[model samples]
Target: MDPMHRMEQLVTELNQHNYQYYTMDQPQISDKEYDLLYDELVTLEQESGMVLPDSPTQRVGGELLKGFTPHRHLSSLWSLDKAQNIEQLRNWNTRVLKLVNDYNTKNPDNPLPEPGYVIELKFDGLTLNLTYTNGELVQASTRGNGTVGEGILAQVRTIKSVPLKIPYTGGTIEVQGEGIMNLSVLNRYNETAAEPLKNARNAAAGALRNLNPKTTAERRLNAYFYNVGYSDDIQFANHQEMMDFLRENRFKVNPSITYFREFDDVMEQLAAIQESRGQLDYLIDGAVIKITDLRTREALGYTDKFPRWAVAYKFEAEETTTVLNSVVWNVGRTGKVTPLARVEPVELAGVTVQNCTLNNVGDIERKNLKFALGTRVFIRRSNDVIPEILGKVTEESDGEEIVFPEQCPACGFPLEQRGAHLFCNNKLACKPQTVARISHFASRDAMDIETFSEKTAIQLYDELNVREPADLYTLQFDDLVKLERFGEKKANNLIAALEQSKDRDLASFLYSLGIPNTGKSTTRMLADHYRDLHAIMNATAEELVELPDVGGIVAESIVTFFADPFTQAAIEKMLNLGVKAQAPEAPAAVVEDSFFSGKTVVLTGTLHQLTREEATQRLEALGAKVSGSVSKKTDLVIAGEKAGSKLTKAHDLGIPTIEDEDELVRLLNQQG
Candidate 1:
C-alpha cells in the first residue's frame, strides 16, 4: 500500500473515533485498537516526511510559540447582559416584546412572526472564536475586547474534540464556543500534578493561553460550538436551523440547547437548569436566553455592549447560614495573632465548609462577629473560593462573646496590642513562632533548603535546642544522625542543603528573616536600591520612604526591625558562621522615559514568557516600583494566565491592567 494513502486512511479512521468518543459520548473502537491505528499514522508520517495538515497526529502539541498575534474577529462577539432573578428576566422579556411589536407596527405589510426563545448553558470557561476557511480550521483566538482577539491556533488544535476539517467547504466561517476542562479530567490531572489547579475555569483558560501547545494538549481540553458568529454562504431563519447546519458540518454542538415559543416556558427551563447544574460534568455560571427567531433578533438589534434580544440568567452566588461554634487564635511566623472561626460543617460550592477566617479582632468587632458564637452567621463563597462570614444572621446576638486573648496561645507570653492586631514580643521564646520562622526560612522562595519542613523544625526545636535561624549553622552531622528518623543519608543531605543555603542572594536572605509586613517584592526592592546589606541595615526611615511605593508604615517597620538589638545580634552570629548573603550584580541605569517609569506596578499570576524575578528586575530597571498586592495606589497591573483575586481587585479598583502577554513582552523589550 502507498504510504501517503495509508496515512490518510488512518487519519480519517482516528478522527472518526475521536468524534465518537468525545462528542457523541460513544466509542466505536477499543483504546488498544485506536492506539494501533494512531501508531501506524505516526510512523508513516515520520518515514515519508509528508504529514498532512488535517492529520490526527497534528493534534499532538507542537513547539512553543514566542507570543500571541492579534486576530481581528470577522464579527463582534458581544457581551450578554445579566438577569439576577426572575423579576429581572421578566423585565427583559417585556423589553423584547415591546421591540418586536414596534418592529411589526413599522412594517405592517410584512408582519414579523411571534418571538420565541432559545436557552443554552452559559459555560464557565474561556470563550473561543474559531475561524474556518474552505472547511479547514484556519485560525483560533480568544474573545479579547470583542472586535479583536489574541490568536491561539496552535493551542486550539490540541483539543481533539474540535474537528480539523469539516464537510462544508464554504468561503469562511467563524464558530463561537467555550473551551472547558471537564471536572472528571481535572480531578484526574490534579491527582498527579505537582501544583494542582484549584478551579476548572482557570485551568482551562490558562491551558489554552499557554505559550507551549504541549501544555494545552496535556490538559485534554474540550469545546462545544454554540453560535455561527460569521459565515459568507450561510443564512438561517432561527437558531435551531443554525445549530442543525453546525451539526451537519461536523462541529461539536452541545445537546443542551433548547427552543421554546413561550416566555413562561423559558423561565421554567431556567429553573430546571439551575436545579440540575450540579449533575453536569462541566461548570455553568448561568443560562442564556435568546430570541429563537432570526428576524426578531435582527429587529431587536444590539445595545452598545450587549444584544437587546438576549440576556443571561445568572445563578446566585453560593451562600448559606451556619452556626459559629467557636473562635481560636493562632500565632504565625511574624508573631502576630489571628482569629480562626470554627463553624458547623455545611456544604457550599460542592465543598464542606467548617473553617473561616475572622482576619483579626478588629474584623470581629466590625462584623459584630465577636458575639456570633453559637449563632447562625451568613457565609458566602465568593468566586468559588474560601467561605467568609459576612455577618451574623440577626443584628442583636444573644450568644457568647469571643474573648480577646491577653496571652499568646502558643507560649503563654503576655501579648501586646499593636493597632488592630496583637503580637507576642517574646519572638525567640514562642514555640509556634520559632518553628514557623525556621520553616519559612527554609522555604522554596527563601533559602530553598530541600526537605526541611515544619515537622523537622518542631523535632529540632524539641531535641536540639535550635531556637533561631542562626542556630541552624551550628548543627553537627553527628548530632543529626543520632536523632530519630534521621538516617546517615538524610542527615548528610540536610547538612549539605544547609551549607548550600549560605550562598543565597541578599533578597532571599532578607525574606528569610521574616520582617513584619514585608513581602518578597519589598525585599527585592530594598536589595536592588541599597545593594549592600550593611547599608540597608543602617538606613533611616526617612530615606526608605523616598523610594517608590514605600509608605510611612513600611519605612518605620524596616527601620524598627533593624534597630532591634536581638536582630542585630542574630545577623552578627550568622555572618560570623560564614553565611554570606551575596548581593546581586550592579543594576542597569534607570530608564526615566519608559512607560513604566515612576509607576507603581503589580505583577500577578504565572507568566510563561518571563519569571516573576525577571519581570520585577525589568520593571525596576525601567523606574517602576513593583508591588506585592493591588491597591488604589497601583498605577498598572500586568496580569498573565490564570490571574485570580489580585486581578479582580485591580478591576474593582478601576486600575488599568495589561492582560495581553504579547503587549507586555513588547513593553518589556522597549529601550529607554
Candidate 2:
C-alpha cells in the first residue's frame, strides 16, 4: 500500500476507535496498538505536509473563547463539595450527626429521626440543567457561572438519555443531570472521528457547547439525571425514591446507587464504590452521599450554595497498565535531573495519558524497574492526579539495558550525583538551564511577565543573544525582529508584554525571582514580613526563616541570591529599566479579635455562605492561615455544607470541627 493510502487507513481506524471509546462504551483495540497508529499518523502528516481538518491532534486545546455570553439557567445550578478521602467522609457524617442531634434536642416533642443515606457515583462530567413544561422538555443549559448557563437545548435534545418530552403528565419541573460520555464511548468516538477527543469530559463539554445541535447528536452524548431542581405537585419522600422515579420514567440514573441505614454503612458503601470504580464502564471520581429522608432534608436546609444534606466522597486515582517505551531525564530549574517515562498512551480515569514522572534515580532503583523498551508497567495518576509510574516489568525478559547519562543533554557538562538527583554544575552556561530559569522567573507565580512563555524565552536566548531574564528589559525592537519567526508584529507584542510586567506587586516579583522553595504563598509571607525588597535582601537567614511558611532552604536561597554581586547588579539594571519591585500596601487593618484571628484553618467541602475566594479573604482578614488541603498543621476544619474527605481526615487526625454556617458565624463573632 502507498504511504498516502496507509495514512488514510490509519486515520480512519484511529477515529473509529476514538468514537467507540468516547461516544459508545466499547473499544476494539488495545491502548498500545492505538498509540502506535496515532504516532504513525502524526509522523505521516508532518512528513507529507497534508493536514486533515477533523483530526485527533486538535483536541489538546484550541484558541480561548473570545468571550462568554450570559446564559440564564432554567433552574438554579450549584457545585458540590469535594471529599477526597475516608476522613473527609467521616467528618461529613459527624456534621450530619451534630445537625440531627441539635434539631432533635430543640424540638423534643416533634423530634426528627435519623435519616438513611443514598450513595451514588458522582460522574466527573459537566452539570446540565433541563427544563420541562407540562412534562415536556423545553430547554437545556450548561451550568455557566451558577446564575446563568449557555442555552444548549437544541444540542441537549440530541442526547439519547435526555428525553425530549417527559413520560409522566406533570407540572413545571426542572431536572439536573450530569452530561457525560463514557470512556469506551469517547475512545470509540475518537477512533471514528477525523480527530480523537482529548478526554471524555472535554469531549462531552465541547460537544454540548457546540453551536450546531446536529454535531452534538452525531457524537451520541448521554445524560444521567440526578436531581429534581424544582417541581410542583410531584414530590418524593426522599432522594433515593426521587432517583427511582426518575429511572422509572426512563431517565438514565447512575447504576451504582445504594442506600445505607447508618454512617458506618455509608462508609462501607463508599469503600465498595471505590473498589468497583475501576471495573465500571463509566468514569466516577467520587460517591455522592445524600440524606434519604425528605423531611430531614428540609430541616437541614441549605447555605448560600449547595444542599447541606449531600457530599461527594472522592476516590483517589487507581493503578493500571501501559508499555514503557523509553526513560528520559529532565533537568528542573533547581538543577535536579529527574527521570521521566515516555509510555504507550492509555486512558486513566477520563484522560488519555502518555507520560509520567519517575521522580529520581533512587525511585527508579528502588522499584527495580526493567529499563527495557516495550516493558509493561503499572501506572497510576497519584490521587487521580499527575501521571506517575508505580512499578515496572509485568512480564520479565532480557530488557533493554538502561543507564543514566553522565553528562547533561542540553549542555555537555559533567553531571554530579547528589542523593537521588543528577545535576549539571554549569547552571550559568547551560542553554536549557538558562531558558528554564528565565521562564520560571517570568511565571505568573514568579515575576509574572504576562506574555513570556518558555518557547518565546528559548527563541530570545537562541536567536537574540538574550541569556538572563534581566536581558529581556534591555532588548530593542530592532534586535527582537532579528530573531527567527520574530516578525514586526510579534516583536511589538513581546515589548508590550515586557512593559506591562514592570508594575507587578512585590510578592509576585519576589516569587518570580526564582528563589528555591519560595512559591507564591511563601513569597507573599516574606513580602508581608519585610515590607520591601531591600529589607528581604538584607535580612539574615534566621530572620527570613522566622516568617510564616518560610523554611531554612528557602532562606538560604534568598540569602545566596542577594549575596551574589552579579544578581544585585542585574536587579540594579532592572530597576534602571523602570521595573517596580516594590510590594503593594497591605489591605485595611483587619479586626484584631476577628473570628479566625491567629487560627490556621483548612477549608473542606462545599461552602454555601461564601465562595472559596470569599472564605479565603475572610479568614486572611481575621489573621488566619487558610490552606488548600488538610494536614496536621491545620488548627481547625471549617466545614460548611457537604464536607468531604478532608473533613474525614481531620476527624481521624483528631482535628476540631465546626458545623453549620450559623456556628461558624457565631465562632467568628466570639473571636471578634
Candidate 2 lDDT tens digits, 85-181 = 7888778778888998999999999887777888878887788888778766767788888888877766676675565545676778778889988
**Candidate 1 C-alpha lDDT tens digits along 460-518:** 99999999989999999999999999999999999999999999999999999988778
Top candidate (lDDT)? 1
Q: Where in model 2 is the C-alpha error above 4 Å?
A: 1-117, 120-317, 370-374, 383-385, 393-398, 481-490, 586-588, 602-618, 632-672
TM-score of 2: 0.51
lDDT of 2 at 324: 82
Q: How many backbone clashes does candidate 1 have?
A: 0
lDDT of 2: 0.74
Per-residue lDDT value at 581 in model 2: 82
Q: Model 2: how far is 572 from its true place, Å?
A: 2.5
Angstrom error of the Cα, residue 24, model 2: value is 43
